[model samples]
Target: MKKIVRLISAVICFFQLNVQAEEPKEYTFAINSAVTPLLHAAFINETIKTVERSVAPAKLKVLYVELPELERLIENHQTDFFISTAATIRRYQDLGARDVLTASSPFSKNPNRSEGSLFIVKEGRSDINSISDLKDKRAAAGRPTAFGMYLAAMGEIAADGYDPKTFFKSTQFYGLNRDQIIKDVLDGKADVGILRACYLEDAVNRKVVTTDQLKFINLKNDPEHICLHSTRLYPNWSFGSNPSVPPAVLSAVAAGLIAQKPVGIGLYWSVASDFTAIDNLLKSLQLGSYQRFSKEWFWQRIIEYRFWVLGTLAAFALLLIHSFIVSRTVNIRTQELKESLKRESQSFHEAQEAHRRLMKMQRAAVVGQISSLIAHELNQPLAGIKLYARTLQRAKDSGTLTEDKLGTALAEIRTDADLAAAIVERVRSYAKGARSERVSSEVSELVNKAVREFKRQSGERVEVKLTQAQPVHVIVNPLEFELVIINLLRNAAQALQELGVSNPKVDLTIRRSDNSAMITIEDNGHIEKETIAKLSEPTNSTKADGLGLGLQIVRSIIENHGGKISFSQATSGGLRVEIRLPVQEETK
Candidate 1:
C-alpha cells in the first residue's frame, strides 16, 4: 500500500510539471517602434520573455506599432501590457494603462533618474558650442512625443528662460528613422541632433553611428556612468499594462522583470519607481496630457465643479455689482479731483520751467563773468559744468536722486571738465611755444581702448560690440577721442536701459566710409528720430538733469580735431551717432 501511494505521488508531480510548461498563458506586449529603434525593441522583447504568467510561466506575444497608432491599440485594449519611455508610458496611463516595471541599471543609485538627453553637433560646427548658442538653430529629432529625443533637450532651453517653441529657427521630425537625425547634423541639414542618453555609446558599439565627426555638447559630469548627456537625468523606460489585465499576471510580470539580469549598458528591469519627474517634465513643456488648457478641457472642468463654480461666480457678481455702484457714486468727485490735480500739475510745471530758464540765465551770467580769464569757446561748456555742479549739490541735499542719474550727469561733467582742462593745457603749451600732443592710431586698436574706457567709466551695465573694424589709422589726441566715444556709448546705453530694451546692444563699427575713417555707434534702443536729430542742439537734452550741452561739447572737440559729427535714425530703431575723422596721412 505504501509503494502504490509513492508511485501515484511521483506520477502526479511529473504531470503537474509537464502541464505548467506546455500550457503557458500568452500575454500581448506592445512596443512603440517609432520611438524605439529595432535593436532596442529586440532587447525589450527579450525582457518580456522573463515575465511569468501565474502558475504557468508567461509568454509574451510581441506587437510592434507606430507611436501615433499606439492610442488606437490602447483604446481597443488589444495589448495587455506595453514597454515604452516614461514620457510615452504616461500618455498610455492617461488611456487606461498602469505602469508595472521600470528599466534600471547600476549606474545610478536612484534607478528612476537613469534616462537623460544627449545633444549632438557635428565636430566642425563651432557655432553650436553650448545650449544657449542653439538659438535660431535648426533642430532635428525623432518623434515629437519622445522625451529623450525631443522634449528633454527642449526643456533645457525652456529652463534657460527661452520659449522653446520659437527658440529654434525651425524644427523637423523624423519618424522611425531616428538615426537620420544624427546624419542630418553631420550632413549640414540640421544644426543640432537630439538623441537619448547613452545612444552614442550603444550606436558606436553596434556600428550604427559611425565616424568621429559627431561631438556631444553641454555634457554633464558622468562619473561612473556609461555615457554623456546634456540634460539632468529623468525616469527610465517603463513597462505597464491595460487596466483590464488581471492583477496576478501583472504581479508575475513585475517579479520576472525585477529578477532578470542586466542587459546592454547594464540595463535591466526593476520595481516601479516614481514617475513624478516625467509628469512634471510634461507639465513644464505643456506637452502630452498637460497640453495648454483647451476650451473643451475648461468646459469639462466647469462641468465637474459646476456647483462650486456657480457659487463663486455668484459671489463675484455681487462684488462686481457693488463695485460698479461704488465707482458710479465716486466717478464725478474723482474726475473733479483729477481736474484739480491736473491744474496743480500744470502750474507746477510752468513754475519749474520758469525756474529752469532763470537758472540758465544765472549760469550764463556766472560763466560770462569767469570768461574774462578763459577763452570764449570754453565758456559755454564751463557754464554747463558749473550748472551741473549746482544741480548735483541740490540733488545731494534732496536725497531723492538715483545713482544712474548721478552717474550720467557726473560723466558729462567729467568729459566736459577733461575737455576744458585739456584746452587750457594746450593754450599754456602754446604760450610756452610748444605744439599740442597727438598720435596716429589704428582705428580698430584705438576703438578697443575706447570701449575698455567706456566700460570702466560707465560700469558693465551696457555691452559694447565692436561688430566690424578696419585697420585704417587716424590722428587724434587719444584722451579726447576716447572720452568722446565713451560719452556717446554712455548715452546710447542709457537710452536703451531707460526705454527697457530687451538686450541693450551698442554696435560700434569703424571703417573708411569715404575719404575719412567713419566710426558709427548704433544701438537697439527706442529713442525717437526727432530726439536724435536735436541731441546736439544747445539746451535740447533728453535727461532731466542735463544741460543739453554734452553733445555740443562733443561737437566742439570733434571740430577742433578736424572731424564732423552727425546723427540719424539707426536701422535698429535707435540713435546712430557718426563721427568722421581725417585718416592719418602717413598710415593711409
Candidate 2:
C-alpha cells in the first residue's frame, strides 16, 4: 500500500509540473502611442516576437496607451516593460524603472540617437516663412502628450522665444498621427504643422505628401544627419523595465530587444544611450521628469534648506526696510520743497503789493504838482477880474460916465468874469486826474479849439498857423485831449515869448496816415537840444518858473490813448512835437 501511494504522488507532481510549464509567464508591456496605429501595430508585433523568442512561455501582453496612461501604469507597477521616447523613459526612470535599450531607425544618421521636430508650412506661404511667424497662426501638431513630436516641438518653439501655449491662434492635435496635420496644412485649414524629424522625409518617400507641396521652417543644415530638423537632437525611444519586474525577465527582455533584427522600415533596438540631452530638453520645457515644482515639493525643499531660506527672508526684510527708509526720506524732501515754494510765493506777492502802493503814491504826487500849477495859472485871471470889478464900481459912482463908456465897462467886466470862470473850470478838469469821458472828436476841431484857447490866454503873443487836409477823427476824452493840445501850445507860446523873436510862430498840421491821426506841432522859437532831450521827463523845466509837467502830461495822455509822442528839433530852428493817435472809423 505504501508503494502504490508513492507512485500516485509522483504522477500528481509530474502533472503539476506540466501544468506549470504550460500556463505561460504573463508579462504586461506598455508602449506610449508616439506613432501611427499601423506602425504601432507593427512595432508591437516585432516586440512580441523578439521577447517571446528569448524567454519561452512568456505571454507578452501589449498595451498601447498615451503618455499619461503610460506614466500611470509605470507608477502603479502594472507594466513589466515599456517602449517609449527618451523623455517619457526618463519619467519612468523616476518611477523606479530601468532603461534597458534605445530604438534606432534607418532614417537616423546616428543609430543610437533620435532627431528633433520638423516645422513645416505650405510652399509659397511667404507670410509663414520662419518659425517666428507662427505667432497668431493656426497650427496642427501631434498628440499634446507626445514627446518626440509635440513636446519636442514645444521645446523648439520655447527655445525660439515663443510660448507654445499662446503663440498660435489655434492649435489642434491629432492623436499619434502626422497625416492629419500634413493634410490640414495642405488644405489651408492650418497655417503651420509640426512633426517629428524625419517624418517629412518618410512621408515624401512613401508618397504621402510631395516635397514640392511643403517647405521646412527654421531648417538647420546638418551635413552629418542629412535630414530636416529645427531643434537639437536627443536620444531615441527606449525600452525599459519596471523595478518590480523580475530580474530574470528584465535581462531576457533587454537581450531580446537588442538582438532584434531590422525588419520593415529597417528599425531595430540598440544599447541604451545616455539620456542627458533628453533630460535637458525636458528640464528646459519643465516637462516629464523635470515637471514644474509642485507645492509639496517646494515646501520639502524649503524644509531641507531651512538656513538658506531664513537667510533669504532676512535679506528680503532688510531690503524692505531700506525701501521704507528711502520712501520716507523722499517724502520729507518733497514736503520741504513744497513749503519752500509756498514761502517764495508769499514773498513774491508781498513785493508786488509794495510796488503797487509805491506807484499809487507817485501818481498822487504828480496830481499834487499839477494842482500847484493850476493854482499859479488861476492867480492872474482872478487878479484881472478883481481889477475890472473895482474900475466898474468907480465909474458907476462918478456919474459922469457916458452910455457908450458905461456899456463898454460893463461888457469888459462881463468878459473878465467869463475868463475867470473858464480858468476855474480848467483847474477843476486838470485836478480830476487822468479819468476822462472819451468820445470821437475831429482832430481839426481839437486843434482849432486848442489854438483859440491859447490865443485867448496869451493875448496872441505867438502866431498859430493851422493846416488840415481832411477831417481826421480820433477816439479820445475831448477834455483830456484838449488839455494835451493846450499844454503843448502853452509851452510853445512861452518858448517863443522867452526867445523874443519878431516873427514867433507855431505851425500845427493835422492829417491821416493809415489808421492813425498825425498831429505835428512845429514851433519857430529857439529851444536848446538838451531841453528837447529831457522835454518829456517829469519835473524837468526849461524855464525857471516852469513846472516841466506840461509836456510829460501830454506824452502820458497820448500814450494812454494808444498813441505815440516824439520830440525832434524842428527845421525852423525850434522844437517840433509829433503826436500819433489811432483814428476812429466814420459811420455813414
Candidate 3:
C-alpha cells in the first residue's frame, strides 16, 4: 500500500513540474463593463482574435466584469489582461497591473485627452450655471465614483473651493446607462445629469437627442478640443496586463496591439507616454492612488487608543503617588516607633500632605502641563464671537443690519462655537493618543476663512489683500489648519500694527510649486534677521508676555501636514513667511 501511495505522489509531482515548465497555451482577458459600452461581446471577440493571431499557438479568452469584480479579478491575478478607463489604470497599477497599450477609441481623434465629463442641465433651466450650482440639486450619473460621469464633474466643484462629497442633494447613480441619465435629466427625473463628454456629441450627431435639449455647466473654452467639455480632459480607455503575466507575453501583446490596423469600425490601440494630466486630476480629487493620503489614519489610530493612553498616564501618576506614600509610611513607621504614640500620630498627619507641598507641587505641575496646550484651542473662536458681537452692534446702530446680514453673522458665530467644541474633543482624542483626522481641503477656502476672521478683529487697522492664488488642495485637519492660518495672520497683523506704516499692508499669496503649495504671507514690518534665524529655538518671541512658542507650534503643525515653513527678512524691510505643503493641484 505504501509503495503504491509513493508511486502516485511521484506521478503528481512530475505532472506539476511539467505544467510549471511548459509555456501557457491560453490567457484570459477581462473587460470592465462599468467603464465603457464599447467593450461588448463583439469588441472582445475581435480583440481576442487579434491577440491570439499575433501570439500564435496561444489562445485568448475574454470575460466582461463589473468594476468591483474587475478589481478583485485583477488583484487576485485571476485575469492575465484587462481593458479599463483611464481613471482606473493607475488604480490597477497599484494592484500589480501594468498598462501595455492604450485603447484609442474610434470616437475621438485625441486619444490621450479623449475622455472627460459633461454636466448636463435642462436647456430651459436658468439657475444652473456652473458645477457648483449642481449642489443640492437632483443629479444623474453612471456611478458616484465613475470617472467620466461623476468624479470629473466633482473635480470642478473641488477646484472652485467647495466640498464635492456633499454636492448633490440627491444622486441617481444609474449604473452603466449613460443614455438613461440624459433621458432622466430631460424628463425632469433629475435636475442635472453627468455624462461622458463625447456621448452628448454622439447623441446630437446621431439625432438621438437634439443639441437644444441639454446645457453644459462650467463649459471649457478650449476651441481646439473637439468636445464641449464641462471638465478637464483625461485619457481614453486602456489595455493593461496583470503583473503575473510573463514579460514575453506582455511584449507580444503590446506588439499585437501596436501592429493591428483599424479593425471593427476603426477601433485600435495607441501608446500613451504622459499620464500626468490624469494623475493630477486624481490627486486633486484625492481618489484612486491618492486615497490613502486622503485618510486621517494617523489621527484615527490615536483616537482609538486615546483612552488607553490617558488611562496609562493616570495610572502612572497614581503609581508615583502610591510609591511615595509607601516609602514615606515605611520610613516614618520604622523611625517613629521609637517615639511616643501622640508624637508619631502628629508626625504622620504632618507628613500626610506629601511632606507639606511636594505632592501638591508635582501633581499640579503634571496637570498644568497637560492643560496648558488645551488652553489655546478656544482663543480664535472666542475672539471671533467678540468681533461678531461688535460688528452686529455697529451694524444695528448704523441701520445697516439687514435680516440676511444678521443671519450670516449669527451663523458665523455658531460655526466658530462648533469649531471650538470640536477642538476640545480633538484634544481629548489626542490625549488618548488617537490619531487626528485629515481630509482633502481647499487651501484657498481655509486661508480665506482665516483672513476673514483676522480682518474682523483688525477692523481697518491693517490692510489685508490676497493678491494671488491658485486652486490647490491639501489633506489636513480643517480646524487645526484654519487655526494655523489664523495664528500666522494675527502675528502678521501685530507686526504691521507695531510698524505704524500709513498703509500697513499684509499681502497673502498662494501658488503651486510642483507637487506642493507655496503660501507666502508678507507684511511691511521690520524684524531682525538674527531673530528670524533663531525662531525655531523656543526663545525667539519678541513680545515680553509672549509664550515664545507660536512660530514653533506653527512650524510643527505645518510639518505634520507634510510640509515645511520658514521666515525670512524681506529686502524691503518686511517679514516674509513662506509655507510649503504637499498638494493636489487642480487643472485650470
* C-alpha lDDT of all candidate models, in order: 0.72, 0.74, 0.74
Give the C-alpha miss distance for residue 542 in model 1, angstroms. Answer: 86
Model 3 TM: 0.47
Better of 1 and 2 by lDDT: 2
Total clashes, candidate 1?
1
lDDT (Cα, tens digit) per residue for candidate 3, span 1-588: 546544544454344335535764677888887644543345556677766654445567778887777777876889888887767767656667776777666566667777788888889899988766777999889876678878778777788888777777888887776778889989999999888777787677667788788787888866545677888777788888887766655665666566665665566778877788778777887766567455664566668899998999999999999999999989887775656777978878988866658855744543343344346546667888888889999999999999999999999899878877876786666555565689888888888887886665445577777855568888888876776777787777777776677778788888988898888888888888787877756436666656345666677568878899988987778889899999865559
Q: Give the lDDT ranking, best first.
A: 2, 3, 1
Off by over 4 Å in 1: 1-26, 34-43, 52-60, 106-109, 206-212, 263-266, 292-588
Give the per-residue lDDT of model 1 (tens digit) for 387-424: 77888889889996789879988987887687678757
Model 2 agreement with the true structure over 421-512: per-residue lDDT tens digits: 76556555645543656898888887787677667555756888999899988999775676678778877877777778788888999999
Q: Which ranges in model 3 have alpha carbons more than 4 Å from their true place? A: 1-21, 34-44, 54-56, 205-208, 221-224, 296-588
Give model 1's TM-score versus the native structure. 0.44
Q: Cα lDDT for residue 569, model 1?
A: 86
TM-scores, all models, native as reference: 0.44, 0.45, 0.47
> Model 2 has how many clashing residue pairs?
0
Model 1: lDDT to the true structure: 0.72
- Rank by TM-score, descending? 3, 2, 1
